[model samples]
Target: MRIKALALAATSALLLTACSDSPSDTDIQAALQPRLEGASCVTAAMFKSFPVTLGSTFSTGVSSGNAPAFDALTDAGLLAKSDKTYSLTDPGRAAYVEQASGFCYSQGYEIAKIKDISPNTGPMGAAVDKSWIVTVDIRQKPIAAWAKTPAIEKLARNPENLSDVPKTYHVTVGRVKGEQGLKLIDPRFSIMRGVSVSQGY
Candidate 1:
């Protein structure tokens, strides 16, 4: 009778362990998809600065360097040009981020695929509280209409020859077990490079 009781207890423990297993890749991906999809993607240039001088000369000549892009934006009704100087319209101001010194063009990113999932280990090489590092391929969604113009698209493309803008970005996401079961945690979406214009510009 003692032996039978021990066996039953062991079986119950095994069942409990199995039930508390970490979420699978599929489950993690499903939870992470919406989060990634809601993250906005911006451009490296275009609206490189905010609060454009209302009366300053925004030379559209070759000397301006970004004349084509500026003209495209002006035509898109984002910029109001009086003679040569440029100022942000209501719509433009709505898109502008003075702190970022640029505008968000693309709506968000989409999960292309889950690349890998590995146990997040501590310095001692032991798993850290049921945590994992999830790597995924994410693609930027379609950009705003104002940003689709050739000049604007050209300005946004990292490599001039690259047909797609931010086609696939390899991002690392964190997942950990919580009281509410497994939950997706901090995702390093800032790994995306060339997505910000220089403050000097």
Candidate 2:
């Protein structure tokens, strides 16, 4: 009789354990798909900074000296350059994947795949006027336990991305109208990247 009771308790515990695990793919997608609404960008660059941070948007007129770093990113093919104009390109996302992969690798995350692409426009007073949305599928490195650190925790909490329902970044790239190009607008990801932002959209 004692053995049977122990067995019954173990079975119930297993069932409860399975129920409390991470969310399913369907749940994650359902949570993620709705937030994709915004301005349409030609390339992935516009949303690169889609949820424009107040730090980048509102300034005290102090320079952080990262302009040349952005220039280097353009030179490295991460950003699209056409006729002396630069914007975010698919390659830029790839470069960012490589960059993020390095950090995530330590936490057992890897660059897996990018699923859907969403493009949209922003509100009249929104910081980013135009944007591109990306759904990235990231997987954990097998055999490594990813202990969620502060960065991982922060990424998990961004409601624009997954709402802790999914484990990947719902990213965006911001864009702007171009001064000189066959393309009406180029992703504004450079020092000259604020023509659209300045428009108060």
Candidate 3:
């Protein structure tokens, strides 16, 4: 019914730092497209439990019970399970924590930071019969202007009616099993439909 976060553009400064190469503007937008489409879905998956099997394999992790968030790590032997407890095979709790902080959805949104992830019956479960809710800090342009697309200024958050910049928006990601998936639920854009800085910030 309304244009959501994924409907817009994103590639917060955090994503740029992920690589040493400087991606073209097109590359950045292309990278963020999937995230815009399923922002909510992955957001939901990101918070869901990393499957009991996966959870017990790592002291910390985040992902949909349905989605294999750490299949690569598992293959790498970075994680293992002994009984019901999950432990990192690598040394140092700090290293484990650092690895755990990293996550990415099927879409392109990178999990910059995870404040908390809890298991729950969420919209994503409507079709899969299982799902998990996650609260995460999604890194996106502080304002649409940063993306060089000012048309959706309404969808971007601007505090104090000031300049655009990089910002971290806390969001809840989930799904209800429809045509599109993972619609982001953000309070900031509730009124974006009818308001814009051009209209007079």
Candidate 4:
């Protein structure tokens, strides 16, 4: 009788352990999908807005060096150049972000793979607030229409000009266990423009 009781107890413990195992990759990926899909990556500085003087030459380090890009924007109907000065068209204004001070080219991203998930432990080795550091590979979705322009693609190809071009980025994501199961916390990821020594040159 005693042996049977011990066996039953052990079986129950094993069941509980299995039930309490960390969430699977599918679950983690599902949690990340919505966040990734909703996010947009933009050029770091190529589309940044600058003060324009109507009828005067739109002269700036950025404009002077990347005249082709400016011309492309003009061709795309996003900019209007009159008397050598450039101004944003209605569409350009719509794409502009005041906070970023740049035109937005919304690009989608996805979780390529979940590399690792390790417990976030405190100094004493106890799990910190039941959190884990999830390492993942993030890759861009299909290229957006605006970014597919030949000039834009050329700009992106130049590593010095557009650092934020679509590419696989390895990042650490934060995950915490809550009442509702595993919840992703900080997943700060974005493509940004590369800083050029001579503006767009």
Candidate 5:
């Protein structure tokens, strides 16, 4: 996946500013491991509507639905659902690490760096700013191999097989006023795989 230009510049600036008392590389990596692993958490709305497993089925019209994704996310301490909205918790940051780890192991490579992008308010309260970011780099060859189309395609595909009827992925999982719950999300956006970035990007 491509990093945003402004984000890249800002990230560089932040790293430059933080360079004075940065953690040792080993400690940094250790600190970031869990976040990367839990990056695949899904919203409650996604869990309710999509076919997450071979035979799992969920009702579309109802507000309450149980999902394996949520269970996994909650167990991993990566996701939490209140009302209907689904958001990542502290443990979910390992998503980046999980991606990097998979790439390294599958392609025979090394890790170079890990970048963390946290959640925060942006300039003038305009856009949502990435609170923190950890970037991890690996051996060029391994990264390239892992980034190839086949690997990406495999990761991109949904883990569950839905009915022959096609379904879209959506991120809505909450009330209208705020991050309340699943009802907040509009119905039009209905893609099945909510973990696009975590799964492939």
Candidate 6:
């Protein structure tokens, strides 16, 4: 009788332990997909810093009283929420990388280093206007080849080779007049790079 009781207790404990463990991959996937597809970016101002949240939206200036459009992300498991210190999950990072890759290919450009981008100016009037000052190591060889080819230059120089996002983007060329080495400017990156501009969304 004593042995049977001990066995029963052990079985119950195992069941409870299994229940409390991290969600399965299928569960994580289900939670991540929709949020990634329709992710939105909230400004760091919405929170105290990079990953800190100020209690709730009432304390911050975030619109919609939520973390902008990516609100669904946390529940989806793509975004981890530990008492408001949100961080991207592994799946979330993969999604970001994929999006960045697509944007690079679309613009006839590539991102040699994601960290190289930063805001030339501070945050703008709205929460989303903040942009990064991108330093594009111009693929001169490919561009030069295209220039030599017939009719490519005209198509490349067309005004349509720009984006139409709401935020402002800037670029730091390798060298420009009135500066040395790399020169930063108050330019729009999405337009100059001919890619979709987004704060994060």
Candidate 4 lDDT tens digits, 32-145: 666666434333454556444322135443545456656666675667887556788887777667666455555456666777766555332223245556677766565446
Q: Compose the digit string of candidate 6's lDDT tens values, residues 33-139.
A: 32223222211323223343534345543333445323444544445676646666765454333423221112243322222444335543342322334533322
Over 4 Å off in model 3, which ranges? 1-110, 121-126, 142-157, 160-195, 199-201
TM-score of 5: 0.20
lDDT of each: 0.54, 0.35, 0.33, 0.55, 0.33, 0.36
**Residue 80 alpha-carbon offset, candidate 2, angstroms:** 53
Q: How many clashing pairs per prediction, in order?
A: 0, 14, 7, 1, 48, 4
Candidate 2 — which residues are off by over 4 angstroms?
A: 1-108, 124-129, 142-168, 176-201
lDDT of 5: 0.33
**RMSD (CA, angstroms), candidate 6:** 27.6
Point out the worst 10-residue segment of candidate 4 by lDDT: 191-200
lDDT of 2 by residue, 35-153 (tens): 33222111222233411221232461212333333343455444554533445566445323331221111222343556654553444234434454556665433311121223222
For candidate 6, which ten residues in a row score worst on lDDT?
A: 138-147
**Root-mean-square deviation (CA) per prediction:** 7.1, 19.3, 24.5, 6.3, 19.3, 27.6
Better of 2 and 5 by lDDT: 2
Candidate 5 runs further than 4 Å off: 1-20, 38-111, 114-135, 138-201
- Assess the local accuracy of residue 7 in candidate 6 as a C-alpha lDDT between 0 and 100: 100
lDDT tens per residue, model 3, 1-201: 245554443454445453323223333333234454421111122323332333321444421342232332333343455543344554212223232332221222343444543445445434543233444444432322222223222223543222322234434443335534444433342211111211100
Supply the global lDDT for candidate 4: 0.55
- Among these predicted structures, which one has the highest lDDT? 4
* TM-score of each model, in listed order: 0.51, 0.22, 0.24, 0.51, 0.20, 0.22
Q: lDDT, candidate 3, residue 43?
A: 19
